[model samples]
Target: MTQYTQKVNETTLKMPVALLQVGMFVCRLDRPWLGTPFLMQGFLIDNRETLQSVRALCSHVFVDPNKSLIQLRSPRERRRSRRETPEPPTLSPTVDRDMARLGLREVLPTYTRTLKGVKQALREVGRGHPLNPERLAGQVDECINALIDNIPAMTWLSRVKSHDDYTYEHAMHVSLLCMVFGIHCGWPRHEVRQAGLAGLLFDLGKLRIPKALLGKPTPLAETEWQLFREHPKWTRYLLEKSGFEQDVVMACYYHHERPDGRGYPVRKLGTQVPLAARLIHILDAFDAMISYRPYAQQRTVYEAIRVLYHGRNSQFDAALVDQFIELMGVYPMGTLVELSSGEVAVVIGQNHDARLLPKVAIIRDRNKNPVAEHVVNLKQLRDAEGKARFRVKSMLLDGSYGVYMQEYTRHLVLDASPA
Candidate 1:
């Protein structure tokens, strides 16, 4: 191959603003550059604001570089440039609507406790202890049951993140995402649990990699990259050693594989990838994109969904991506947003019966004042004339307009309590 072609393949990819890190050269935006903060055509990302500024502008951008100093890697793109329209943020008419949204309050306990169990098991695996595959399976069961009962709570918990516990928490979140997806697709309980187990075990192989490489704050060297992809074999060995089902082991082995055969390890294309692996791959990418990692920036829920949408067919299963968009809707729960009414809010819950009009905590007034927060369910909300109560003007940066979901949720509970 010519050097230029190699450089282009090695360099440019469509990346969400959240994953962009300091020192990477951002060569393009999702929109025009005329109104942006940058003066030059391409500039090094210097600080946190660079990402906040970029996210405020567009969902994705062209990041052109052979490498990065932050050791950050680009998410695989489904299309090559020329942004396509995002799928209309709508729900599938065929879905059960209340697939996992049933009996939420009663099932909340099972969902909350399973995360702690999974975290402890993963920590043991990191220390080279044997994985209790059965224990993991049980947690997967709990996870699936929890989602099967109360999707909004499980989904909301998934969005609550911690930078220090990223690996463990990511595994837990991905597991929840997979279970939710399975339930959404009308999969049987056994199938849903299997998918959840696979998500929990997706990164078992990475535990074998050296901490220096895994924890590197800067862009990794070519050698480190080589070392990174070899963890699949290690993961397989660990899973087998721990007596996980063969299907579960294979899922972890191929979660990084893509539909076009462009992914790592086996590089199997299309249906050659296991179905469990395919489901895990999409949610894994979704969680990684939305969550903060020391190595990469975090994208908004919209940006992450859009990247996944554009990647369909070429980089991911087109049908699965569509289902994911349909599932998460235009705004997933916990998303901080600016409404057309000029109110600042955080999505707190989702309507299960129909549509993706999520419930939001209105934290700031249209005039941008800190308001006494109250919840609004978008689906039922109607103006005097009876239109959709409000629309999201644009997805906002998480902490912008002084709205943080965790803090807002805490106060919400307290304020609702009787004196």
Candidate 2:
């Protein structure tokens, strides 16, 4: 029999790769961490793909039992667990039935309407007209209400829609993400709406920047960069002059501020920054990275999430970054992914507690050809052999294998009407 090392007296235990589970915390790899694709030095095996990767990478690893979500068990129990196939976590019946009641089709109109409001607000700022607070408040209220009723539908719309005009589109995306995150944090409805408004108006200052500078594909000169940093101040000035609430104005002003004091326009660090400002900061950075910008190419959702994780406690608020990751989950809405069965699908709904088992809309078959759209709930799916039927193999970029979210909007019952 092969000798297996299990140091019960130490904080870290040596475990064979075959004994690893989804909730296990892998603290050290047998090989150099840099050689592998993991973003964090130590992380939990949150999903099947990560578990498989670790099995393929090393024969054994060091796991921190205290950091793991699962309990350390006897070798007999561990062997039994390895022999039984693990199933995705299941959601409560009431919650499952409630989620099924709402769909993207029911929420698309509200999303489109809120997007128009975002565009109109930018137009007001550009024309030097005062932003109509009443109009803005109405739109924000409607959007928040829609999100409160159905988070997945709103998130799907935000991820799928990308306008040629990046300004308002980016604003809309940030605002929706902020509201969703606020709800996840259990904030009151009024507070969630405030965060959404602040995010929607965070970048009005950029409208005051020069068009040449905004569109410049090359690096900005020092003088130009200095001028660009002044936009946050301009944003504050514009919002205050329009008689907006002080909280909204301040959030917009400090949205660029970083926890490490490296951010522009005042460099407020730590607890000195308001909670709303900190929340907007993470969402703003994330949407910008994933959006098509003048100087930067669009990144995949997973790529952007990795950047956020690496930047925690430095570029963004640490707790808020963790909360955002939990809110978005491993496969966020609208993520294009390839299944182990070779078909391609888009994540459409989250199973709440079961973050790894999101409901996906299958759009392409094994041959990578377009097919009639169908929804698959990964949590409940099982094959004739009673094993898990589908598992996500890997997440793909926006246009991988000719799968683009924009091209499938019609099938999603969105972008079919004039915006």
Winner by TM-score: 2
Q: Write the per-residue lDDT of candidate 2 for residues 155-272, one digit (tens) a residue.
A: 8766764448678788888989888988888999888888888989998898999999998999999999999999999999898988988888898899889999999799899779
C-alpha root-mean-square deviation, each candidate: 19.7, 9.8
Q: Give the C-alpha miss distance for residue 5 in model 1, angstroms.
A: 64
Clashes of 2: 0
Model 2 stretches astray by more than 4 angstroms = 1-102, 352-354, 381-389, 414-419
TM-score of 1: 0.70
Per-model tally of clashing residue pairs: 10, 0
Q: lDDT per model, in order?
A: 0.73, 0.81
> Distance (Å) between predicted and true CA of 164, model 1?
2.5
- Stretches of model 1 off by over 4 angstroms after superposition: 1-108, 349-358, 378-389, 410-419
